[model samples]
Target chain A: MTNTNRRVLLKSRPQGEPTPANFDIVDAPLPEPKDGEYLSRTIWLSLDPYMRGRMAEAKGYAANVNLGDAMVGGTVGQVIKSRNPKFKEGDYVVEYAGWQSHAVSNGAMSMKLDPNAAPLSAALSVLGMPGMTAWWGLMKIGKPKAGETVVVSAASGAVGSVVGQLAKAHGCRAVGIAGGKDKCDYVVKELGFDACVDYRAAGGNLFKEIRAAAPNGIDVYFENVGGAVQAAVVPQLNDFARVPLCGLIAHYNEMQPSPGPDWRLLLVKRATVTGFIVSDHFTDMEGFWKEVPALVKSGKLKYREDIVKGIDNAPEAFIGLLKGRNFGKLLVQVSDDPTRS
Target chain B: MTNTNRRVLLKSRPQGEPTPANFDIVDAPLPEPKDGEYLSRTIWLSLDPYMRGRMAEAKGYAANVNLGDAMVGGTVGQVIKSRNPKFKEGDYVVEYAGWQSHAVSNGAMSMKLDPNAAPLSAALSVLGMPGMTAWWGLMKIGKPKAGETVVVSAASGAVGSVVGQLAKAHGCRAVGIAGGKDKCDYVVKELGFDACVDYRAAGGNLFKEIRAAAPNGIDVYFENVGGAVQAAVVPQLNDFARVPLCGLIAHYNEMQPSPGPDWRLLLVKRATVTGFIVSDHFTDMEGFWKEVPALVKSGKLKYREDIVKGIDNAPEAFIGLLKGRNFGKLLVQVSDDPTRS
Candidate 1:
């Protein structure tokens, strides 16, 4: 088996918005697995906005990616050689393998991905963290009722797409906030959202636009993006509105506290705002897996993937993700998938 | 009856912090009680931070106080004249009687007050809105486990004192944040709080002081103040912390949004923040009155009221209340309590 592995290391922390210089791409030899460990070749590397938080030295839910260490991420990989009884050679698995082509694991965080049920790449995207995030925030926290207006930011992206679709499934008016005309169009047309507000569009106030879109006022807000988008939606919230704060992607690159409206907005609406980490609520993932895939298989729940080729390009893809450049679930196809053709 | 009602009217909206000029002292003729109606003389007027929100023309939980209208507030009063069967003459009741010395009501939002049980003044304080506010936030939202650390801002004030005492009763460590050393002393020494930090002290960071007070990290936060105090508390919050946002007195006077940390602090901690209006949760007040008085009777709960004399002093007292000049629950004794004297 080839021992050579290519890795992308976090060279330096970003001051504000991350640039390519902050990442160092290098080739290295993979170490052999001892006793209870196994070697896995990366098939899919996830490029998420969460990685931006991991890059900051500032305190967050996850530890920051230290200088000269592999930038931490979720990945789908296939075992090339095994020293553990639980995993065998050619078996596909999903794990936190970071930004590396090869990883040696004792299988503490790794979970077996069924190759027959779905594509191995789906493990790092749809059928994995992002899917659970959308499900957990929408069904668990947002708790949208039938005929209620639910709004999601970054609505064409990974988690937001699922949130809007799930809102529709639950008999809600799903209004999405997306970056451009294309994403906004895709969010409404392809993602089956009731309406999509183009945040990039100029002229009238965005707050007024959101109010017009959700005329009865938002009841369930799936907060994946913060800043002007959050400011706009907060005032338009109905009494007893629910905000499931899944992400703050818009403020991840912010140098200082964003100048925004006070908690008075939340207080005035008597809203419930909850911030949750997907890992903390994984007990419900089984229910999500059982439900979402069936919806996906029947074409009732559709998904889009933005697959950028190779591990070296992961840094640029991740940076673009923070800038709202990626249209859907962003992934770095690091190597050829053994589970697929 | 004299038929003259002394009132404090909201003459003009304050530019920033409310001043004496924003209020107008006026004498108006009291309307005669007609069929199915009654007239009540205000014995005790309750001054709360929530009134600040009502003063703002912006959308909030309740309607804004229109210019030249009597400022709204809760008041405990004796029914002087009654034309209704439910409320007889000379019976005590609590109602939203605004800032007027006398009011006529149809008994819609009025509740009979027990004059024999506690002081009629207690109907507007410990045994009333503020006490219930503390209980609802601490139990419904905070949900503190035994031995968990709970932090509350405005610790010596009406709601905070109750919250701290309640936390202790529930077997939780209560750390308080107050504006001065005297209030801090009252919170810690008198209220049985584990510790209290003086937010106005020099040199040391408020966050550091809070961290020191709550060594294990804050599990539940009762947010009454929301400026530097909130900023300090947010970072010290432990994972899965609950925040019952009852008020933002610190931001109430602000012309714009206070520059503070984003909700990322909450998201990273996986915190639950609920903003509530006590009026919406009055169904549980029956339960509060039943249980809380028992605790108070057994010396498990202690309350102190900072009572100001005269209906004329209400405007200045309310202005001082915003400045944190009052030591405890701030209330204006409008007239001689028929039950007390």
Candidate 2:
């Protein structure tokens, strides 16, 4: 059979913000399944802010996506053909298939997904990396005690939304900081955050707003944005407060080191700030599977996805994700499902 | 009896670097000991970096030295007279007597010094607050494991000297970062550090020096100087490394907010930086007194003191301390010992 597949590759590294010139869409031959490998057609692709770090040449938790390579990503796919005994033709699976319409995997790095267990797209979102990030960061780093205030930036987005909900479930006073009024309202009204600060509004004095909302002081600052917002929230942190440094989306596009008053004050206050990548904690997957699913099942955890139809729109959707245009977990639906479509 | 005593009080708040105008030396009446009290004559007065924080009006862990109050300090003094059963005439003790030649205190905060047990000045240096700062910061925050590489900045200073020794005793590779070759040599030869980086000679290439010294990456950073030195040491920290931030002498004199490319990148490396005042762990003093003195007796730990003579010289000594002019634990020899005199 003739092989025909489309893929998005990193054509060049962007100096600052990624533009269309940074990526190239091209048609390619889909590979045949080798021994112990399975051929899969991409059903859904995840577009995350961390992808920006992967595109940069700087040393990060992971290696940079090399030029002329398909941009790396988390994808949920349908097994079209299989040489591996664990996966069969017509099975659904999740894998790191990049921005490709199809891929061949050895099944070692792939997990079987039962569409009947949950929605297929959930494999790329709430049941996936973003969900695990929120679980570990809130539970391990944030450590929100009962009635303690947990302030999360990017409040209505993927990890932050889940973090706020999980914190609420732990009997914490959840406060959200989001850019727009709409996102702020959603976080407070639907996600049950006690207060929501609209960072985009006029007279947006973050220090004032945070102090007003959390008079007792912030116990856990779930840091996602790391420029001026960090400067404001840091002073309001109580002694022994914990900060889970999940992502610095604000400085991801910076070509030069961002200017700042040093964070030595964080040390003075006896506060703790830690960074983590979810992949490093794969050893804790058993514990995660045991806890997160129950939280989701009981509605103690919730998630949302902004789905764009077709693989052709993946690059644009990813760029928008970094710019905070997407309300929640950003996903590109790459194919029609016989079950849903 | 004639009441003639020299006292130094805070005349005004400093705007940038403290000046002689900010302090007033005056003649005051010798305070009489009340019931359950003792009148103490200052002998050796401690001038520490924490005192700088106390001089400021800013809200910190400890109360600021109020304007018009005698500048607060730790002192090794002699109880010239006592009204309490716990003390006797001519008893040597340690007290919080500020920069004054004479003062009265209730037995509440005085620790009787066993003049034969250790040097009287040891009560203010290696055996007292500075030593405790190192003890708690290392055992509690730095948590150095055997075979780990521990890096301490300000290596010849009071706290740094103790930290380097303790790390060496714990079987960690103790590397120090000090301002000059002399200080670096003192850290390596006298203080028992495995290696020492001369931060001054490092110029703008401190990161390179740190990388060269700690090829395996640093597991504990005893952070005392927090500016360019901190920026250099951070990138060399291993994942899950601990930083005990005891001081920020580099920025202590600044009136305005410090300019910076924020060191939040340090947090993103999965390292923990924690600031603490030694007093917060007063509960741990029993444990420290049990451990540190034994280490000192066995020749496993070492310390140094820079003693300036006379109460009149304290302001200069303190100012010099801020500029890194005074080496090791800075102290003022307030008066000639009447017994020796």
Candidate 3:
């Protein structure tokens, strides 16, 4: 194992689409575990859309990542040293270890993961925050009822894939909007989505394509990507439609905030729209754990991961995530997972 | 009484803002009521902002008024002839009587009004649709808790007036936004809103003024008039703010649908926005009746009227209403109210 800690730091804030120059990969002395803290080596570093919001100077739900600081993210790691009685060396855990190879946790907001229960890397994807987000936004806000049509944007991505599956599990018709033929095929054939629209190839007929897919019109829209996708999905909403505004990845890269869809439709349709963040709902984690992990373990719910080899590649991988390049849950493999082969 | 029924018909659909030329007041031959129906002489005709939407070809929650067809409206009238057992001659009732002196009702959706309980005109405003709309949207969707700041638009107007008063009754800090000094003063001084911002005089500092008034940030925003007012109010939303989108009168006359507020704010604040029409929620009317009328009768809930006399002036009065010319609930008195004098 390397004696040095390699951290990806936010070098500059992006004006629009993020580039590699916005981040700096640096080698620093290994961090020490202080009293009531345990040090862990990051095995899998999460690359999520919300991190883009934190890099910007503009205020969002959470505080921005200060300039020259290590970029913040969730990670699955194995403890190397411990001062906290609750955690010990060699135990695998999940915490906000950020975009770094090593991190110290006081066990305040960390959870232990049993590798035998699920894949260690799954702690960063299907069995973790993304899964819980899908469960909460889809069930709590979207409130998909049986026989209703549920359309999800970014269907092949981590949260979207889970949302479509959950919608299907609830006996609702699940339609997906994806970027390309491969992802569209995966969403339909592999993920069991009722239909998947290839938005990139749909040209100017996106609205028509979505309408054709959802013959009864969309009732619960899991809005993962905003902009054109949202504009198309909105007009096709059924009366009393519920939209859980989970992410707006398409507009995150725009320098100027773009104009949104005509809200008159909301009034006309008598729709309910709720914008949610998973962190605010962590208190409901027990409810999520009661269902999702079991579904994932039984092969009832499926997930995919696009893993980059190193922490140095996290910046490029994350930028691609914004552009919908990563096929599934985008994660950087920071170190060898002792639990895995 | 006149031998002919005077009716206002849709003459032409307005391209943008409505004009007097869009309507034609004409006299039609009086017709006899058929079996299971009653004929009534229209007394008070409600002129509301939503009427602007029905004049155009664009479809809304309710059907459009066809060209050359009498404008559809709610009215409080007295039955002159009855063939239906549910109604008796000289019974004062409220129904969708349209913009005409006489209407034939099957009594499928008509309610008898007791003038002795309150003023007959209150059936068309404070104790009726507008009042019930305020109650449902505020209580059901806005969900304002005690100590929260609730801001209402179109203050001193029928629906907005009730909304502010209701917010205050719930122990919330109620602020209002209206067009001029008179309406603002009336909202604060008479209607009991904590503060009222005159958007006309606020100039470019509407957001600044609203933020100043809502020092703790707006928790519940009763959105009546959209466009600039919505744009200004949205940015000041506190975390988990609830917005009940009751109307968009500001955009009602625009030929093309205008772009809406920056929806990113919704995600950032984790806000919940609901767009509702009162017609869809008539089933909840029982709860509304249980609370609102008693408040109005007890002098705790206040209402005002801007009455334009005679059916001949209905067209001009309605045109003025869309431009915020009416200071209160805009109504056209088609005939002398026996209950009033």
Candidate 4:
């Protein structure tokens, strides 16, 4: 086996939108697991918007990824060797392997993944962190009841896609807000969202379209995109509405202050807007893993993956992610998936 | 009886700060009680910031008041004539009687005020809607726990004054934000708050003072005044903090857009900001009336009333309330309190 390992590291903090120069791909010798540890090979690396927040120097919900350190992320991997009784050779696991070709770990922070239960790549996409983010925020925070209208922004992206579907399952009229007409169509047609508003059409008409779709007024806003989309949604919220704030993807690249409505509007509606990180409520994770997989297996829940081939394309793919270029859950296939192959 | 009733009506909607021209004092013939109704005379008229929102053309949580309608408000009055068996002459009651000398009401919308339990005028202040507003928002929404820090804005106003006192009772560290040095002094020295920051001291140092006062960080913010006060408190909120949004008096006279921090800050701390109206949770009113007055009577709760004599002064008093010129709950004595006189 080739003993060469490669990693992508943050070269410098970004002022606005991140460019390739802010990151550097470096090669090193492959790491080996000692006693009571396991060696894992990365198969799929998840790319999410929250990664941008981690790249900055500012303190956040999590620790900032230091310059020259591997950009942090979730990964679906194959365990090649195991020194502990908890694992064996040819086993799959979900881990925080960061942006690397291979990793050596004791498996304490990793969850064993079952390839036969669903596709192995699903662990990095729908069946993993991003999926949990959508579920927890919508279920616990948004809490859209029957007959209420639920609107999800960035509707074709990983978290937004699942949020809209969950809103549907909860007996709500689901509306999607996506950047383009095609993504909007996919959200409405494939995901069965009640309606999808194309935000890229015209800034002035976006609210009108959303208003038309959710005639009852928005009861739950699963906020994934910030800026104009949130500014539009704030006025449309119903009294006693709930907003589960997940990500501010639109503002992730923004250098200037984001434009929002007079926050007095939130007071006018008696609404609840909460900023939440799923990690704070991981006790609910066990329940999510049990419930979500059953729904996915029964075709009651649908997830789409926008998979890019090879580790070399990760930087470009992630850059495109912030611009809303990729649809559904964005992931990079760093190595061949043995189960799929 | 003179049989002449004095009333204040909305004369014109102001573009910014409301002036005397926006209100009119006129005398009209008092209407007689019909078969199912009773005639009542206003004794104490409550002037609150919410009335400013009702004067505007835009619709809000409640319906907008038309130009010629009597300015809506809560009033403590004595029934002069009763056609219904539930009420009798000389019995005191609290009702939404507007800014008027007389009211005709069926028993459905009014609560019988027990003068023996508390002072008749107390029904219009601490024992009334303002008191209930403080209790419900602080309990149901803010939910401050033991040792946690609680901050109440508009610290010397009716709702905020009670919010800070109640925070102390609940074993939480109570901090306040008021407009003047005197008000800030009264809040800490007289009202039992741990600390109070004067928002009007200077714009540059208000946030610094608030941060210093709440050295442990804020866990619950009872938001009565929005604008800069809210923007300052946003950075100090702890993870999973709650904000009970009751009113935005600081922006009540604002003609231009009110400035607040980009709300993405709410997403950072995983905090909850919920807007609430006391009217929505009136069932809790019974509990508030029972618990709060007991606290007041036992000296556990301290209340200050800044009462102005004559209904003619209500317009100026209300304007002063908006500017934080009045130190405590601002009310107008419309007539002799029959329970005392």
Candidate 5:
């Protein structure tokens, strides 16, 4: 029990794009579980675009990571010691442990994960927060009717992949917008999207490309990227189109206030744009957990994860995520595999 | 039977804000009703902020006014002569007659106005398009729940006035944002809003002022003005707040693209902003006509109109509307009182 915990802590606020200088890797004594608390060792860490927002001083759904604090994140871990009666030792659980090797959590903070039923890492990727985000966003906000067209940006990533697949299962023409030909190919062929658009392709305007892809016009735009991508999709939206705004990765690093032509275009199209956090829909998790697992089992839903080898690389993987470098749900393997335990 | 018709035709598109020079006064021989047609002599011509969008070349809900075409508008008029069985001479009706002294209408075009029941001008103001805009926006989009806070911009204008009254009637706390102290006073005292923020008097920091006015946060924002007003209102929006965007008068006349911090802030709030055209909601008019009239008759709703004299002055009145110069529903008295007919 003499293990030392190493973690990345926020060193300073980022001006625009976060640099390595903004983070500090430091060592601390591993936390021991107190009464009513559990000592959890991190197994897999989730790195997401939303972490970029958490790094900023501006107001967002979650508080910004304060200087000298462990960067906030969702982690899948194994409880090694539990003083709480509800959680037993060796139980795999999901917890908000930030960018740390080990954590002390109260029973209230963790959801037990069943590794025997599903892949243990899937709890931090497809079957977890990212999966739930797509479920709630598509089912609740996007509300894609049968035969409708749904377009998602960053389509090869965790949430977008799930969004596209779920939309397909709902009888929609799922269109994926990804960065490169490889991701686009994967989204279309592997994820079963009706079509995929390569946003990085030269000589093709996004609006023109999307318009060509969706002739009847996009019914739902699962907005994860804002900027030129949003501008392109807005005008092509059909009357009463719904935009489930899950993230704005494009402008997360922007130091200056965003320049705009105003959002009057959204108004003129008679479209709806709404933002949401997955936690806001937590009350409906009973319906989500019940429905999603069945979809996964039936192979109606698919997910992908970009796994990093160690906790030390989580910061770099997170930085890559903000730049759209990750091909799937970004996760960091924090410790040795538990199956050998 | 001999009538001199003075019509305002679109002369040229204005570079910025519209001026009197952008329109031309044309005289023509009054048209006669043909088979199944009726002649309508304009009584009150409605002037609205949306007309500014019509004057632009940009694609919008309706086709932009072509040069040399009569400026389109809604008018309440008298059927002076009828060749149609459905309409009779001397019957008051509502028609799309543009800014004109007289018009010839087919039986398919006019809705019989209840002259004895309410002011015929009411058909062009509160009981017609503006009133219906408020009704559909509140009922369909705003969905004002009991105890929710409803906030509207341009609070003394036709749509805003109706929106406030309807919100109050639904047992919500209604807050109004208007330009002047008078309009603010009128909205709170006369229209029954819980409070009103005078945006102009507050030195344009409407965000702070609105927050001070609605400490509970805004549930519904009836957006007519977009720009700083929208920027200010967006942050104060409560979770699941509904913004029924009826107009963007603030940006309508500007030729250059509006510079800004991007509207992507809309994505983080989990709020919905949707645009609507009243004409698109025409299918629901029977419901509106039935409910609104009852509310008006029961003294639960009140309306106001600013009547400008003469058809020749419609262009000036319309220009004034874009500047927020009109206190209520701006209308032109196209002909002498048809109630005396």
Candidate 6:
């Protein structure tokens, strides 16, 4: 283990798409575990679309990451030192440890990880925030009934993959809107989605292809990447359709705000569009932990990770994530996972 | 009483807004009631903003008014002839009697009106579709809590006026948006809304005026008029805010569909925006009738109607209504109300 903590800090807020100049990497002395706190070596750092909102000065659902601070992120780590009675040396934990090699936690929101049940990194992917997001948003908000058509955007990504799979489990036909042919293939063949529309390839035909894919019209739309995709899906929404708007990654990088779908469609269709953040619904965590991990263990749910090596490459990889360059749940492996063979 | 039925027919669909050319009035023979049917002399014809949608080629919540057909409308009439056991001569009834001096009804959605309980025309305004629309949309969808601010557009109009009063009754701070000074004054002084912003006078400062009116930020927005007012109100919505999209009167006359407010605001506020039409929720009618009419009788729920005279003048008054020229619930009194003093 390194004696120094290499941390990436927010240098500036991005006007549009984030560049490497907006981030600053520096080596600092490893943080010490004070009384009732434990220091953990960050093994995996999750790069999510929401992190883009955190870097903006605009008030989002959550607070923005202050300038010159370590960029906030979800992390899976191993405890190397401890001062808290609840934690011990060598204990694995999933916490909001930010973009660093190590972090000190008072164990407020940190959860103890069981590497034997699933890979430690899985806690940062399918078994973690993204998975629970899909479960809660789809079931509670989307409310897909049997024989309904459920369509999800960014379908190959962390949250969306689980969304499509869960919709299928609920006896709804799951259709996916993805960026490329490769991702579309993975969403349909590997992830077991009924069909997947390649938005990149479809170009002007996106709406037509989506309409063909969701022949009976969309009953529940799991909105992950909003923009042109949203405009297309909205017109085809069935009467009393539910839209669980989890993310708007398409607009996160824009310099100016874009207009949403014509609301006349909502009134005509009697649709329900709800915008939500998973953090506000933490009360569902208990139920999620009970049901989701079992599904992951039984091979009912599948997940993919685009793992980038080293913390130094995180800025570039994150930039790629916003542009749809990375497939699946984008993550940075800061160090080796001891549980992985 | 007139021996001929002076019916208004839909000559053509309007391109942007309805014109006199779009309608054709003709004198036709008075219809006889069939075995199960009843003939009535039309006393009041309710002219609502939703009629604009019915005249359009685009598919709205309900079916479009077919060309050459009598323009559909809600009416309060006195039954002059009856073949059905449910009705008797001189009995007041509220039914879809169209834009004519007389009509026949088989009693599908027709409601028996009691002039003694409240004014027979009250069934077409305060106790009818508009009142029920305001009641259901605000309570069921907006779901405003005590100490929260509820803002509604089209403040002095039939639905919006009732929405503000109901919001006030629910312990919410009721703010309204109307077109001009007179309507704004009537909204605040007579109907008891906390404040009313004049959208025509506010100009570029519309949002500023609205923000000032709703100092605590809007928690519930009963959307009766969309477009600029919606764009202005959306930014001030607080966390977990609810928006019951009841109408888009502002966009109803447009040749092209206008864009809705930036959805990013919805995401940031975690708002629930649901679109609904009162017709779909007729089950609420029983509860509404039991509760709302009593409020009207006690003078708790105030109402006003802008009554125009004669069946030949219906087209002009309807055109004026679309332009916000009518002050209150716009209605055309086709014939004398014997029940009225």
**lDDT at residue B96 of model 1 (Cα atoms):** 88
- Model 5, runs deviating above 4 Å: A339-341, B259-261, B285-287
Global fold similarity of model 6 (TM-score)? 0.99
> Sorted on lDDT, highest at the top, how do the candidates line up?
6, 3, 1, 4, 5, 2
Fnat for model 1 comes to 0.79
Q: How well is each residue in B139-254 modelled by candidate 3, as lDDT tens digits? A: 99999899999999998899999999999999999999999999999999999999999999998999999988999999999999998888899889999999999999888887
DockQ for every prediction shown: 0.65, 0.56, 0.85, 0.71, 0.65, 0.87
Candidate 3's residue-wise lDDT over A205-312, tens digit each?
A: 999999899999999999988889988998889999999999999989878877877789898899988999999998878867888888897898999999999998
What are the RMSDs of all candidates, in order? 2.2, 2.3, 1.2, 1.4, 2.7, 1.1
Question: lDDT for each of the candidates?
Answer: 0.88, 0.85, 0.92, 0.88, 0.86, 0.93
Rank list by TM-score:
6, 3, 4, 1, 2, 5
DockQ of 4: 0.71
Per-residue lDDT of candidate 4, residues A193-280 (tens digit):
9999999995799889889999989999998888888878889999889999898888887766564567678888988889998878
- Pick by TM-score: 2 or 6, better one: 6
Candidate 4: chain B TM-score equals 0.97
Each model's chain A TM-score: 0.97, 0.96, 0.98, 0.97, 0.96, 0.98
lDDT of 2 at B41: 84
lDDT tens readout by residue for model 1, B132-174: 9999989989999999999999999989999999999899999
Interface RMSD of each: 1.9, 2.6, 0.9, 1.7, 2.2, 0.7
Model 6 residue runs over 4 Å out of place are none
TM-score of each: 0.95, 0.95, 0.98, 0.98, 0.93, 0.99
Tens digit of per-residue lDDT, candidate 1, span A1-341: 67688999999999999999999998899868999999999999988888888888888887787899999889999898899999999888998888999999999889998888887777766688998899989998998899999999989999999999999999999999998999998988898999999988933579888988999999999998888898788878899999999998889998887644568877888899999989887775777977899988788888899989998888888888888999899999999976666
Docking band of candidate 6 = high
How many clashes show up per model?
0, 2, 0, 0, 2, 0
lDDT of 1 at A6: 92
Winning model by lDDT: 6
